[model samples]
Target: MSTRTYLPYIACAAALCVAQARADVKIGFSAPLSGPVAAVGQDQYDGFLLGLESVGGKLGGQVTTVLREDDQLKPELGNQITRKFIDRDKVDAMVGLGFSNVLMASLPRIAESGTVAIATNAGPSPLAGAGCLPNVFSTAWQNDGTAEAMGKYAQDTGFKRVYLMAPNYQAGKDYIAGFKRHYKGQVLDEVYTQVNQPDYAAEIAQLQAAGADAVFVFYPGGMGVNFVKQFSQAGLGKKLPLLSAFTVDGTTLPALRDAALGTISGAMWDVALTTPGNAEFVATFAKKFGRTPSHYAAVGYDAARLLDIAVRKVHGKTADKAAFAAAVKAAGTELKSVRGPFRFNTNNMPVQNYYAFQTVKDGEKFGVKLLGTPLSQHQDVYVAQCGAK
Candidate 1:
């Protein structure tokens, strides 16, 4: 053991430490990439990549790597994937969980690991209320927010009675609850169906028999495609005024074609939204993907942008949990949102405008056109329950 030998060892140790400090930022993304909702998840993933591309494949001046996992729309599977992302991949942050159940199941693990997760689509009510966590933030609206806008619109349009339908799940319950909160009209019937129920023939029959003035529903992904096509075939789309949230969007509208035309829905963003950020996002997404981006895609893009802003503020050192959280909170309302005027509520859920949109023919194809704002600068009711300012 010569002093020169010890000096060499010390120099090597210092170099290794420096290398660790400058490691590339890793992000783990989990979503239903191979299930009924696969299309939506793919759109979300694509939008996120576009966001990263906008920043030149880096976040906060640090090279970033994204590891994508398919949750298969299963809560248990999602939890497993999240654990793997934390324990095996050693990701610094996480994004994308398209369904409420998957997001809810993955939360505890994410919280325990001190990983910040930005939800792209699903926003369960419980998380927005008593279960809110500082590490979890949603780039999309709470499940009930858009539904409430549709409900309000239905009330304003003088719908005396309405038929409501949704999948039998946490998001479905929240959607109906939000609608009831704002809709003063009588609900003719409330129907809960299976999550991926392909044929809505039975439900459509019931809807036609109910003799309701309007129909409200919350079906996303492939279920929306099936339901809308069936509804159109059953002649219910023409007979009863159809109103929905998350049911008819860029993801499903193109598939529905003429079937979704004239269908009214409530959403936070559409391709037709008039804003510089939205215009650029729409044009760029169409050019890149050769199709319209969905609301889920918009949120995914915003989530990446938010992460970029926050990581830059913290200099990409997410190991300092408190500083990273502060950076995220500070960046929440500052990121350039495609949806426009985006901010997080006390619960880390979005507080933004909800617009009434109509599925209309756009150059022989179907797309959603913003009709009017049903709710302006809206914050969720669950914010007060979260105990955050």
Candidate 2:
């Protein structure tokens, strides 16, 4: 159930010392470097790489060369790609595996090789509990953590007869499970479909038939683009009112355009998260990327920042895998996350705010704007099973 690596523990400094002595500690980055989810993967890639650049290619006080590979969003491909990073590339650590399926496949590879795996994205559940490895750490929130915020919101707002839909897969199931944990409502229906099915006609037909008062969905990347477009075209946008996990934020919002208007989403930060850190990040990203930074980009940037801080903690010395892992964990605790304060749960997932957001037209551009305030703050109910103190 867990791809946890079992390496004998060592003194933090000792482990770091060994790693630092190595000429160049290699870090592996396995992600959807191509395919439909490339936008999401690219965002993650840019953030982590940016962090590497910012820190001068050193992590934990040791100089590093990032060995990048494309999983192409396939689990088997992910396994093969990870093998190359671990075996041929001789990487000492891994980071930025973008998708859940890819993360699941790569975990065992990391565990077996005694390499630290720092996830910039994709925090699947199994790794958080019984399967948790001391070697694997996430700079991103877990799979269901954000959806759990929506569940709590539904409970707070008193929305009964809500319909839920997601791509039929491990992550999709986890998202709905997290929502139902707090929702305590009449779930009109819980629907699932094949992952990345461009057309949601069949599901939309079923949704229209379900006649729920409100709907919650977890469709990211191209799937989000298609679902939102179909929802608007089918006239469900007005009648049912849509609420989302804010994963439908900056990345896919451009694709949805005006159709995303008026829909409610849940996230930790919007383009409007009025803070100095957020303002600088949003401004820089928009100017450089020529578009608003979606929550994905924001998280990507945050991941890079977190990595930089952690690398600095160990002085870029990744030779000591155990020390590097501890340094990363300590760094995570210290980050003044743009979403506000955050700390790692025992399961190594994030406990942070999840806000409700809306897509609004920003003149010639579109962005995810704040809506209804933050629903869940420093929240991740799955923590009960997370084995955190």
Candidate 3:
């Protein structure tokens, strides 16, 4: 009877010690999970969970807890969420920084606290250059990368005059500037519209009057759906060649459908890409979520995989912030990214390929078909300005 009682006590003590040894990995995920852009955030969140599941619901063999927040696509709200993640929850890492504007708003706090942040979308120029932070990394494209690819494609295709349009924001300006860097042609006009503006009759009229050879735009989410639908409604879809980056993607294609067909876009990844493991990722995501995964989802998935490699390398010792950051940076090289040709530059932005894809009818449904790569093994131009030695 004494031996039996003592044996139960010893077993209970061992279980408690094992539990203490495996600490929970806490992650705070913030995104615009409401309003018009909600689909973008939802895809990212779903993909992230899928990735975590692929690793057996643990990141680096540690049980992971994710705190989700919706910023509603507002910078002020994003900043508040960032603060809460850092101050109250004390998350080991943060992801899904939202769009470019929201990311910019939260940049200072992330920079100050030395938090390990992996951006699934919204990589602005400042983060890649003079204002670069050691703890920040983006599994998404730099703001200008896709635009630059479109610009080069226009230049190569002999589109002598191009009209440009985007929402009036930091990303919009960066895209236009990036296009201008490569096009070396006549710019009919650069139009900035209000965010979430539903009407585009005025812009369409301006484009028609300009008589440009092609038009390039950088609208994402609901804005893209509205713009492309209205542009097609204006009867400009056939008359003027439409080109874009993020304006016609999986997120917007379902809404735009036939109207988005024949439109060419610049992107880093798509459901149609044949990169190793991408087909399975696409299939699994579709089966799990009942929707086609966008490039945003791909990035979100990659972000999780990246953290898996990093956290495992450091054995989940994320308390040493600097060491964790270093591990993340090095993880970029080790990961066989679904996007292909991915490695972090000295600035922690991706050096990858950007391709031209055209929306097409895939059997009974709509999808994108790869046209040709516009840029390969490309690093953003701002890397030259980065202070990383």
Stretch of 10 with least lDDT, candidate 1: 1-10
Per-residue lDDT, model 1, residue 155, is: 91
Clashes of 1: 0
Q: Name the lDDT of candidate 3.
A: 0.87
lDDT for model 2 comes to 0.72
Candidate 1 per-residue lDDT over residues 208-316, each given as its tens digit: 8888999999999999999999999987777878999988988887788888889999999988899668889889999989998998889888888888899999887
Model 2: residues with Cα > 4 Å off, grouped in runs: 1-25, 56-63, 362-364, 372-379, 386-389
lDDT of 3 by residue, 100-202 (tens): 8999999999999999998898779988888888899899989999999999999999999999999999899889988888899999899999987888888
The CA lDDT of each predicted structure is: 0.84, 0.72, 0.87
After TM-score superposition, the amount by which residue 314's alpha carbon in candidate 2 deviates from its true location, in angstroms, is 2.6
In the predicted model 1, the residue pairs found to clash are none
* Alpha-carbon RMSD of each model: 7.5, 6.9, 6.7
Off by over 4 Å in 3: 1-23
- Which predicted model would earn the best lDDT? 3
Q: Candidate 2 on 1-389: residue-level lDDT in tens?
A: 01211111255542221232343456677777676677877777666654444444444445555556777888888888778877887776677776787788777878877677767666777876667777787767777877877877777778888999998877888889888887888998899988878898988999899878789999877888889999999998778878877447777887888788878887767777775577776666666567766666666666656766766777766668778777777777887766776777776777777777776676876766665553444645455665542
Among all windows of ten consecutive residues in candidate 3, which has the lowest summed lDDT?
1-10
**Lowest-sum lDDT 10-residue window in model 2:** 1-10
